[model samples]
Target: MQPSHNDQQVDLANTAGDLVPANPSTFSDDDTLSGLEKGPSTTVSSPKIPIPEPADVAEKEPFLYSLRTHKYFITVTILLSLFTDMVTYGIIIPIMPSILEHMGGDSTKTGVLVAVYAAGIMSSSPIFGVLSDKMSSRRKPMIIGLTGLLIATIIFMFAQVYWLLIVARFFQGVSGGAVWTLGLALMTDSFGADEMGIQMGKALIGHTMGMLGGPPIGGLLHDAFGPKAPFYFCLAFAALVIVMLSLLIEVRGDEMQEIRKYAVELRARDLANGIEVKEVVHTSLWKLVTTPRMIAAVTVTTLEAFDLSSLEPTLPYYLKDRFNLTEGQIGLVFIAFTLPTIVSPLAGWVSDRYGAKILCCCAVISAGCFMLVLSIENKPLWGIVLTLVGIGLSTSSFIAPILGEISAVVRRTGDKAAYARAFAIFNIAFSFGMLIGPIIAGYIYHGLGFKWNCITTACILFAFVPIIFFWMGDRKAKMEDVAMYEREEEERKRILAEIAIIKAEKKAAGEA
Candidate 1:
């Protein structure tokens, strides 16, 4: 007859009990006591190995076995997706005014079109973020977004009138929001907090490269082959992104973090070494966003987006009218503003150490000063270039800090937190900035001229200094919380070690 499960456990315990030392002096009393205290709620016994049902394993493995699921590969796939969108977005920037001019429009009309794109992103981010989390899969939402983006690009390619072009941009922004929100969620799933900052910085490299090259490439292509050439270039990159995405196979939480059946020492060591599992708490979206630090971080994201986008409506016209610069030369000037941001990874390393308060305060102030200088009307080409270079260096310093802060707000929850919604809030703020920047900056440029536009932008940036200082930073509260967690981890390790010893003795006695 088969032994009952409880009978088997008792018989096994009796057999292994023989190996225990009678005096019990070899073990630490504190550790043994702690385990006893914790163990009354559940029996501490030898672990049983799990056997996956054959049919279940077969179903999951058959197709997934052929795909790449490594964490590094996931990063690459997401980065490629980001780069594709950014390149296409920027490739059209330098040519937008020209497209308008063909339709008997000006920079003000171009500003409205740019704002429409941002409006799409702002409206779509939260919807996609909610869908991505509820759906419990990143790849499907990402593919759907990409397909829609391609369709929008096709429309943009052949748009003969201004309103049609605006419609294309709005749809393109919606799809772009999906890619960014889900891509960030996927990255958060794959990486732990310790490395997330650097990864985010590296991710922004895609944005930086796109801004650095897109306008120049667009301007040059428009000059050489016509407006259609730039759109074709974007289409090709999007196709390659589809291939990279197809190679990815998403790794779910249980599969990615499998543990041995009864590896007590490994578990204890892992907790001690900073790989932690915390007490679960369901933080609401509003609660996360309303926190002081989070608000500051979101505000900074908006301002930086504004800082870059404000240039789009104002700078192109200013260059054409003031310096008589060609489209290619206007695009080249933007390179000065974008080139310095390539060191984002290094800046991320800094954020990990020093914190956001110093970076945000200093960056905005310096950028304002540079903008004030750039506003001077008599400056030659060299002076304007120098001012842009300064703005780039100063403004780029804050990107990684705000990004790190945004992730840091929820990172203590470890694997339990929802990342898509958090980043969706970030996207909302960023897109809002992009939406308002062009409208305000373009209005000022059209009414008061370019000088007042720069001055007004600088004044607005300077006003944010105190808010940045008051709210954005590394807080003592976080340090105290980390200390508390570490102490709890020590207690947990001791308890686990005692359990391990008991299991070892039981197995040895059973063998005897």
Candidate 2:
């Protein structure tokens, strides 16, 4: 006959217990008295050791996964990194005019400096994305990027030559691309698909803050102290990020084990579904570029960037010429334009719940009409401010929803590794828009007039609405399906768990 399971455990424990001192050297007189009181012939039995049942053991065994546990911390760290990068980029914007003057260059050369930085970002982003997705680890690329930011900050701080300054800006852009790609990809990995939009929105808050505060602080510090003051601030900020990242972020051995398990599970699932998991040699580049969802995301990014960059060069002039506004008034107008971005979190939350189709379409149309209206003659300052505010609010919906949509598509397609490259495409589109928008606006404003530039931009903005309507509408349905799939999967898992528990109980009863 077979020994019972408890008997097996008892025998094993007795064998191991022999290694423990039978009567420890420190055994007390109280034990001797008790033994004597129990009488000589009677042996004292070891306290009955309670062996935990299998189901209890399984229930009590904790999940040792770290990625999900530390997701919020990771998100904060990425946001801080992004904030530092943006601050580094923006710190010099207000001081660029002065810097250019000192170097015997004009505003056009300053524009060249900006363009070169953007060009660097555009060129390096795809490469960074490819490297990140190909690599098993995201931390290495992120660290390298932060190091580049540090080097760029040093260059900007001490460089007396214009060409050196240009080189510094280029490096800065390269670093920005790395952070944007890897950071967003990391966030995607950390969270579920449905939570991505709100998470992106939260990350964007850091960016908006950096943009809002950097220039003003730099300008103020420059006025109060010196040009190098802003660089010093940026340098300190970057250094802090590097240190914080090095200390706070690490994928432990346990996390790596879990990640390997996760990959294996994904591969098994793909095989079960008759989908071929790609080898390392397989390239998703073509697939990424050709996806209609990705095209829509890039298009939205480009148009948004165009609208933003087009305004940067022309808005101040429009306000000055149209209303004779002072510098302070122009600053107020800029604030009014950006103030609506504060509601971006709300937009993201809404997108996550209700889908982004109506929001994206309405935003573009509203922005276009507002732009057309802004071109009207003899508009009051308040009216212009209101119109700009409307434009800002409308445009704020594009980033999070579009990104969430792309992530959803990639996830549905089982190309989870493509997130980094997808965002790299976004960076390219944004950089391209930044490059082309001003050039086109400048040309049109020169060839035609300010009103014509507005007319043209408005028309272009309105055109994208239909594209959004047709493409972005499916997001809600897909999300619903994903939710249903998750629920069904959970139910299946629950049934399996119950069966296993029942089997364990029956096996123990049969042994009895």
In candidate 2, how many Å is residue 163 off?
Answer: 3.4
Residue runs of model 1 more than 4 Å from their true location after superposition: 1-67, 253-281, 412-415, 475-512
* Prediction 1 TM-score vs. true: 0.76
lDDT, each prediction = 0.67, 0.62
Q: Which stretches of candidate 2 lie over 4 Å from their true place?
A: 1-69, 102-107, 247-283, 316-333, 377-384, 442-452, 478-481, 484-512
Q: Count residue pairs with overlapping backbones in model 2.
A: 0
Query: How well does candidate 1 score on lDDT at residue 114?
Result: 78
- lDDT per residue (tens digit) for residues 295-394 in model 1: 8888888887787678777888898898987777887887787778766777767666666687678888998899899889989998888899888887
Residue 114's lDDT within candidate 2 is 57
Residue 73 shift from truth in candidate 2, angstroms: 2.4
Superposition error at 132 for model 2 (Å):
1.0
In candidate 1, which residue pairs clash? none
Q: Looking at model 1, how many pairs of residues clash? A: 0
Residue 382 of model 2 has an lDDT of 85
